[model samples]
Target: MQLTNHDAANPSYWQARWREGRTGWDLGGVHPLFSELMQEAHAAGLKPNARVIEPGCGRAHTGAALAKMNYIVTAFDVSKEAVDAAKVLYANETKLELVVADLFALPSNWSNSFDAVYDRAVLCALPQASRPSYVHACAKILKTGGLFLSIPFTKLHISASEGPPFAVDEANLESLFEADFEKVCHIEKQHSVKDSKIACEMLIVWRKK
Candidate 1:
């Protein structure tokens, strides 16, 4: 699962990871950061039954958890293997929908259809060149005033030159979405990525305007 920046953009890279069970990012269950983010967003007016879309949602543990919390969750990944695994893992979650789709080429009907976009791995997983497009796709699918909850890896464990878990700073985040979103809430906290020198992470919620 050693992916160069160019290989990171190819869907086959992710497909191979899933097939080989090389998903170090898979926590095997919903992360507590998601619960905290939901609580903060709910205080900020997000409610159950709101339509939520999660792009690059490998295995969809968070999506299924959100569905149980009453959100209408649509979680998709470029890897069919990942989506298929998610479907089987949470087969009884009626409110959860799993699909194999590219984030940049989502279905036409999805435009401005989601009330929120949950991004745990998508942004940081992509190469720097594709970030603007990722931000655009998320914004396009979200309705006006929709929330975008994100947990981006703020520090890289490996070399800066090679990564799926890319390092992102506040400036990079702001510059990318300033045109379409306004920062409403932000929290920085410690994380536990194995062998990582920096244990910092960020939970940010932006409101679409």
Candidate 2:
């Protein structure tokens, strides 16, 4: 996926975007791939009782969707405005909690406590240096044998420096999750980048093993 808005490493940049209504990642509705996977996860017995976290949830559409489907969800974003919007959208959903906090600084009680971690754009959105922390955090928040659903943008033609949605590939994922998680499967689709270039889009699932 191409990131139209690339924010700085600082949180204030994103806060400004949210405050100014510059979010391009909020798809307004749940992404079809994520919606299908949520249903598939329910069929796999992770249903009304399962706990999930959506890190860096932009407008929290996916988390809200999951809450509607009976999954307990905690969606966090550094942007207070984003969280405020989400709260307004999900006022009646008791199954979801929206938090305004940095993903790296989540409370200790949350560690290793979730049945699943839904990493939408958070992984690739981070600067390269933060990826290890991100992977560790994802693994930490998920219980053993839990699942991690990652949808990261793969850099095919774009330079690594030209991104908030940084270029990533299987090697990046393996280097991050290989020790504590196993790649169960992955699907890649070519995405159109700027000026007719192509990017490798990946939907990967990892099971903590």
Q: How high is the lDDT of residue 88 in model 1?
A: 87
Model 1 bad stretches (over 4 Å): 1-5, 192-198
Tens-digit per-residue lDDT, 108-177, candidate 2: 9998899888887778778778788888888888899888886677754656665566767778788888
Q: What TM-score would every model get versus the actual structure?
A: 0.94, 0.86
Q: What is each predicted model's overall lDDT from 0 to 1?
A: 0.86, 0.77
lDDT of 1: 0.86
Which 10-residue span in candidate 2 carries the lowest summed lDDT?
189-198
User: How many clashing pairs does model 1 include?
Assistant: 0
Clashing residue pairs, backbone N/CA/C < 3 A, model 2: 112-140
